[model samples]
Structure formats: structure tokens, C-alpha cells
Target: MEEQTIFHIINNMDKVTNNLIVQWNKVFEEDLGVSHILVLGHLKVHGKSRPSDIAKILGLTPPTLTYLSEKLVQKNLAKRLVDDSDRRIIHLGITDKGIEVVQRANQKGVELRKRLFEQLTKEERKQLLTIYEKLNKSL
Candidate 1:
């Protein structure tokens, strides 16, 4: 039998991972985009942060993240504000509405993850998780 290459495994995993993310996006009916949800979720987890910090954490550039932040602001989901001490610093924080969206989105995301992984046995889940962690660290 022929041995499958490492790239083959990575490609296959990327396909499934991306597809699952796409499907989860379909679960949202609100004005919240995936970036908005993720950004809000990060804010909720880490408290307030500068826009540049958020960009760094998410691996997004300033322009791209600025656009997302603007969209969230336009939708009343997030706010970009000046830093209290450093007026030049632009910070981001989720509004009550943003928190609500993150909560709902989190629920939906959890549901989809459960739907995808619940079918696998404990050992299979552990193996997939171990491999996924390794891949993430390798990247």
C-alpha cells in the first residue's frame, strides 16, 4: 500500500476544519459576523485591549481589523475608544449588545462542535485533539 504524505493529511484536515467553520457561520442569523463574534469573545475573555493588540492576537493586520472593528461599531456591537491615559492609543471593548452576540454565538458554536465531535468515540476525539494541537503548535 502507498503511504499518504504529510501535506495530504494537512490538506484534508484543513478542508474539514474550514468546512466546519463555514457551516457554523450559517448558524448565525444576526448582524454579527464571525469576526465580530470572535472579537467580542476575545474581549470578554481578556477584558479591554488596544485595537493593535487585538489585531496582533488574531493575526490580522491593522487595516483588516480596523474594518471589522468599524463594522462592529456600526452595528452597535463594539466600541473603539481612546485610551484613558494614552489618548493616542485606540482601544476596543464590547458593548452589552456585543456581549449578547458573543454569548449567543458561543452557544451556537458549541452546538455545532458537539454535533461534529459527539459522534466520535472518546479515543477518537482524543487522537483528533492531540493531532490538532500538534498542528496548531507546528504552525
Candidate 2:
């Protein structure tokens, strides 16, 4: 691809992402921020996970994860679990409330995506999906 095309694609992708985030902030009524929701979503998908592992997977520092997890625990959305065999090891797990929140967040995300993509034809949406998948694989 030419340099101009590449720059245009990158710029538009950033604009689209920022727009979605702005819209999400307007529509999402939760007190939690994106990082907190990311941690909860990770727990929802992987069940109980060590703080270190979660931090690594999420590209966050251990202390940052601790800060985010603390908020979740305080909100009763998540809990800390001590390993039975290893008391030194701590894991975080999502609570029932956390699951509910994740579901609601996902629903909001789906609705936002629908609204944003509604302007495009179905074929265009499919093409965009394919392009994104390819780009993700490259990463």
C-alpha cells in the first residue's frame, strides 16, 4: 500500500475508535471505567486468574491491576481467592454481580456497534470484519 493510504487508514481507525469510546461513555451508565471492565471481562472469560497473569495478558503493570481489582472488590463485583495448596498465591474471580455487569456491558457494546455500522451495507460490514481480522492476525 502507498504511504498516503496507510496513513488514511490509521487515522480513520483512530477516529472511529475514539467515536465509539465517546458514544460508550455517553450510553454506559456504569461507574466503572474501561480498565475495570477489561479486568472483569477477563475474569468472566478465564474464571479465576492470578493477578500477575491478568496483568500480563492485559498489558498492564501489576500495580495497575491491583488498583483496578481493588475497585472491583470494593464494588462486590469480584473477589480474591487464596489457593488451597499455596496460600501465597492469590487469584481474582468475578462474582455474580460482575457477570451481570459484563453482560450489560457487552449488550451496550453490541448496540453501539449496531448503531455505528448501520450506515454501512451488510457486505461492507463483512468486508470490514475480514479486514480487521486480518489486521489482528498480523499483530
Candidate 3:
């Protein structure tokens, strides 16, 4: 691809992502922030994980992770635990309440996504999913 074509595609992708985020925000208006929801989602998916590992996975700085974690902990959505074997290491996990919240959020997101993707044909959706998986694996 030409540099111009790549740049255009990148710009278009950014717009699409931003638009979806805006829609998601509307659906999750009661939540704290997308970052906190994202953190909870990660913990929900992978179970308990160290703060450093979660930060690395989420492409966040330590301070950013700390801020999000603190907020979640205070909200009673997640808990921070010290490693049983390594006292200094901190692990973060979603609480049962957090699971319920994540589940409801996911349900709402799925409904929004269904409406959002209604314009796409099934074949297009399949192709998009394949593209997303390929891109995800490349990272």
C-alpha cells in the first residue's frame, strides 16, 4: 500500500473507533470511565493478575493503573490483594459485585453492538471479525 493509502486508512480507523467509543459512553453513562470498565473487563477475563502485568497488558503506566485500581477498589468493584508468597506484589481481581456489573455492562454493550452493526451483512461481519483476530494476533 502507498503511504497515503495507509495514512487514510489509519485516519478512518481512528474515526470509527472514536465513534464507537462515543456510543459506548452513552450506553455506560453511569459508570466511572471507560478505562475503569476496561480494567474490570480485563480482570474479569483473566482472573486475578498482578498490577504490573495488568498495566502491561492494558498498555498503561503504573500511575494510571494505580489511579484506576484505586477507584475500582473504592467503588467495591475490585479488590487488591497482596501476593501470599510475595508480600510486595499486588494482585487485582474483580469482586462478585464487579462481576455482576461487568455482566450487565456486557449485556448492554452487546445490545448496542447489535444495533451498531446492523448495517453490515453477515459476510461483512465475519470478514471484520477475521480481520480483527488477525490484527490482534499480530500485536
Candidate 4:
């Protein structure tokens, strides 16, 4: 690809992500940020996980995960558990309420995508998906 074409793609992707964030915030109007939701989603999928493992999987700093987890615990969405065998190890687990919240957030995300892509024709949408999948595989 030409240098200008690559730059354009990068810039457009950034703008699209920013716009999506704004629109998502407007629609969800939640107190927690996307990162928090992501952590909850991860827990919901993987069951209980160590803090360090969660940080590594999410590509987040330990302190950042700590902060996010603290907020979730405070909100009663998640809880920290001590390992029975190892007193030093702490595990993070999502609560039942957390599962419910993640479910609602996921539904909102689906709704948001439907609304956002409503302007595109079916063929255009399919092409866009194919392109994204190819790009993702490359990465």
C-alpha cells in the first residue's frame, strides 16, 4: 500500500473508534468505562483468574487492572478471593450482578452496531466484514 493510503486508513480507524466511544457512552450512559466492562467480560468468560493473569491477558498494567478491579469490587460487580493453597495469591471473580451487567452491555453493543451499520447495504457490510477479518488475521 502507498504511504498515504496507510496513513488514511490509520487516521480513519482512529476517528471511527473515537466516534464509537462517544456514541457508546451516550447509549449506555454507565458509570463504568469500557476497560472495566472488558475485565468483567473476561472474568465472566474465564471464571476466576489471578490479577496478574488478567493483566497479562488484557494487555493492561498491573496497577491499571488493580484500579479497575477496585472499582468493580466497590460496585459489587466483582470480588477478590484468596487462594486456599497460597496465601499470597489473589483471584478475581465476577459476581452474579456482574454477569447481568455484562449481558446488558453486550446487548447494548449489538444494538449500537446495528444502528451504526444501518446506513450500509448488505453487500457493503459483508465486504467491510471480510476486509476487517483479513486485516485482523494479518495482525
Among the numbered candidates, top lDDT falls to 2
- Expressed as tens digits, the lDDT of each residue in 57-107 for candidate 2 is 999999999999999999999999999999999999999999999889888
Ranking by lDDT: 2, 4, 3, 1
lDDT of 4: 0.92
Better of 3 and 4 by TM-score: 4
TM-score, candidate number 4: 0.93
Candidate ranking (TM-score, best to worst): 4, 2, 1, 3
Write model 1 residue lDDT over 17-129, tens digit each, in one string: 89777887888788656877778888889987888889899888989888998998888888887888889887898899888888988898889889989989999999989
Candidate 2 residues lying further than 4 Å off, grouped into runs, are 133-139
lDDT of 2: 0.94
> Which candidate would rank higher by lDDT, 2 or 4?
2
TM-score between model 3 and native: 0.81
* Per-residue lDDT of candidate 3, residues 1-139 (tens digit): 6999999989999997788778888877556777888889999999999888989998999899999999899989999888999898889999998888888778777887788788899999999999999999999
On the 0 to 100 scale, the lDDT of residue 103 in model 1 is 90
Candidate 3: worst-modelled 10 consecutive residues by lDDT: 25-34
Q: Pick the candidate with the highest TM-score.
A: 4
Model 4: residue 20 alpha-carbon error in angstroms: 0.9
Number of the candidate with higher lDDT, 1 or 4: 4
Give the winner by TM-score: 1 or 2.
Answer: 2
lDDT of 3 at 109: 77
